[model samples]
Target: MYNLVRFLQKHHFFILFVFLEVLALSMLSRSHHYQRASINHRTNNLAASIYHLQSHISDYFSLRYQNTILQKQNAELLHKLALAHLPEPQPDSILKERLVDYIPARVINNTVNLRNNYIIINKGYRDGVARDMGLISADGVAGIIIGVSEHYATAMSLLHQHSVLSIRFLKNDQIANLHWRGGNYRQAEVVDIPSHVIPQQGDSLVTSGHSFVFPEGIMVGTVDEVMESEKGNLNSARVRFSTDFGKLRYVYVVKNVYQNELDGLAKIKTNE
Candidate 1:
């Protein structure tokens, strides 16, 4: 009680001045219409600003949830598109079977500088993802799944040295093999192109759909430069990859519904 008394005595003049200032402002606002209106307008604006800031903070925190929902929607749309591309059923045959399915995944880890680049995703065997499944980004092809655990999967990125993708030219449908040489992550080379087929710059390349991994017409890259083979029998071209591996975040795993049937036929042919 003694300390409180001393403190109040020391600051009494300053405290009185602050109290008087507030009292004077209240009286002015109450007596003058212009002052009251101005004060109310300022208070409303401050409240609005506070509310807007709170709303932005909330949206920032909920971005991951929104992204997950969007990913699922995109996967469903891709599945529908695949079904729509299927051939019409014959009069005697029913078209009740689906050809492929897309599983949305988030890329948790990725590398682009290494000779053997790899991508790690949040989905695995439990999520219906499996080895040899094709991985693609929103823009284009990203990688192929090489291993899977219960809750995670690893993929061999298209930028790897040993990576090879079957690609077809959009102009003439000439098939070629896309290979990486361990340099630029954004560039690759398409080889085994026929000598007679000339690929110009800006030519689009897409998946050939020869294997059960990726579906047909998934974009791969664009021709950057043409390099004719020294032997003159085959040609190759530099390609700019459509998917930027350094910025990869979300991807889709392609699951071929008829993989077992295709694998059985492939094994039979191998035995022959």
Candidate 2:
């Protein structure tokens, strides 16, 4: 109590001055329109700044939600595109059968330099991803799912030595098999384009839809160069891949709904 009294005595004048200054300012603000307006203006500005900061924080946290929604929307659009790209002579009922569905997934692991490069994605059989399901990027054809676990899957990249994808000339519809020869990630060779139908440089190649894997017209790449085959009957052309394997981040696994039926028919025909 004694220390408190001494401390008050030492700063009593300063305390009194501060108290009076506050009281005077309060009275001035109440009595003068300009002072009141100035105070209100400052308060409003502070509130606005606080609200803006809160808004930015909210938006930042919602980015993941927005991205997920966008992925779903893109999947729906790609599914429709795949069905529409199906070859003609089909009834509307068959077309509506939804031969293909798209499941969006992120690439958790990938490689481009290896002789047999593979991609790992954050999806599996439980997520509707299965072996032989076709994979594609936003830009073009990517790979095919070769192995699947409950929550993860492996894709054989186009750069793999054993990778084979059926592709067709966009202009003439001439079909050929695309294979990787190793060494280059951007380039693959089309095995059997007839020598007479020369594929000019920059000619686009797309999926032939015969594989029952990738839907027809999904871009593979453009012809970078054409070379004579040692067999002399066919010409092989180097295709520059549309999808950059090194930069693959997201992909869609395509499920061909009618593939089983088609495969069963083929098996029966073979037996006959």
Candidate 3:
């Protein structure tokens, strides 16, 4: 108590001055309209500044909530972007939705070192995913959806020798077939393009979306080397996929709303 009293006494001169000034100002403010307005304005501004500071501090600490909101916003925006790029989904068109109808999945099981390996996703029919769906990573096409359950799905990795994906050149727009040669997981083959098209090195290859599997224009790979066949009119090239199949972690499985109809038609034609 003595220490407190002594400290107050030491600053008492300034404290008294401030107290007297406030008292005079209060009286003057009540007597003069302009002074009252000035006092109120200053008080309001001080309060506003304090409130603004508090709000900013609170926002800075609520990063978890803010991050969740941002993630949701990003997902919604990407969905819309996907819709804008999809095909028109003509009634007779084989491409199902040709738009934003895919579920993002994390790769839980994968294989790239072997000739016959598959991948498992965390999504399934319960998530509106189905079999034969197209699977793609952000960097490029990964594989095709093969089977699905209520809570999970399986993708036929492009590393599978039995897998065949049709691709096309981004430069001359020539169509080709992509298959694994079982040599390198990072590389695949684009085969059977017309020799006349003359594909050059570094040409980009992407999904043709001709079948009911994937959307058109999905990135597949790039032509790293073009080999002219001395025996036939067919040209073969090595493609470096936008995605590293061996290092795949996450993927998106595309669902065509009209996949059944498209596949049925194809089956009917085959029967015919």
Candidate 4:
């Protein structure tokens, strides 16, 4: 009690000044219409700012959950897409089973500036991801899984020198091979194009689906420049890749249901 009294006595004048200031403000606001309106407006604005900050904080915290949901939804949608299924033998025949299944994965490590770049994803053999499975980004084709462990997988990015994809021109169905050379990661080269097929700038390309690694019609890129072989027998073009390797964050691993059977048949043919 003695300490409390001494503390109060020491700060009594300051406390009284604060109390008087508050009292004066209350009286002025209550008596004058302009003061009351101004105070209310300021209070409302402060409250609004607090609420806005709270909302943004909530959204930032929930972003990862939202992204996971979106990835699952996209995988489901990809499974249902007709391009992921084998074509029906008859025009009116019932649709065949889906040829491709997509498993959502997050890229944990990536590179874009190397001659032989590789990508490491969070999914692995435990998640049904395996060697030779195709990898694709939201925008387009990304790479192919080359190695897998129980909990992680590594892929050769499409930007690698050894990475090659069988691609087709969307406009004319011209098949070509896409490969990346050192330098710009945004671009690759398409070769083995037949001379008869003339490629123009901005012409779109997609997966050929012959290897069964990726589904047909998945976007690859667009022609940025047309080039002719020195021998003039084959044409080539520079392609502006659809998937920006530097920005790769999430990708889908493609699983072909008939891959084993197809491999068996291919092996038999090779023996013959």
Order the candidates by lDDT, highest first: 1, 4, 2, 3
Q: lDDT of each structure?
A: 0.80, 0.79, 0.73, 0.79
Q: Candidate 4 — worst ten consecutive residues by lDDT sum?
A: 34-43
lDDT of 2: 0.79
Per-model TM-score on C-alpha atoms: 0.67, 0.66, 0.64, 0.67
**Model 3 spans > 4 angstroms off:** 1-100
Question: What order do candidates take by TM-score, descending?
Answer: 4, 1, 2, 3
> Is 2 or 3 the stronger prediction by lDDT?
2
lDDT of 3 by residue, 31-131 (tens): 34322322332212333344445544554554675466447657977999999687665555443325547678766667787877677766777898766
lDDT of 1 by residue, 102-168 (tens): 8998776678998878777777788998778899987789998877766777777887765789999
The TM-score measured for candidate 3 stands at 0.64
Candidate 4 residues lying further than 4 Å off, grouped into runs, are: 1-94, 229-231
TM-score between candidate 4 and the true structure: 0.67
Instruction: Report the C-alpha displacement of residue 205, candidate 1, in angstroms.
Output: 0.5
Best-fitting candidate, measured by lDDT? 1
Q: Which residue pairs come into collision in candidate 4? A: none
**After aligning candidate 3 to the native by TM-score, how far in Å is the CA of 219 from where it should be?**
0.5
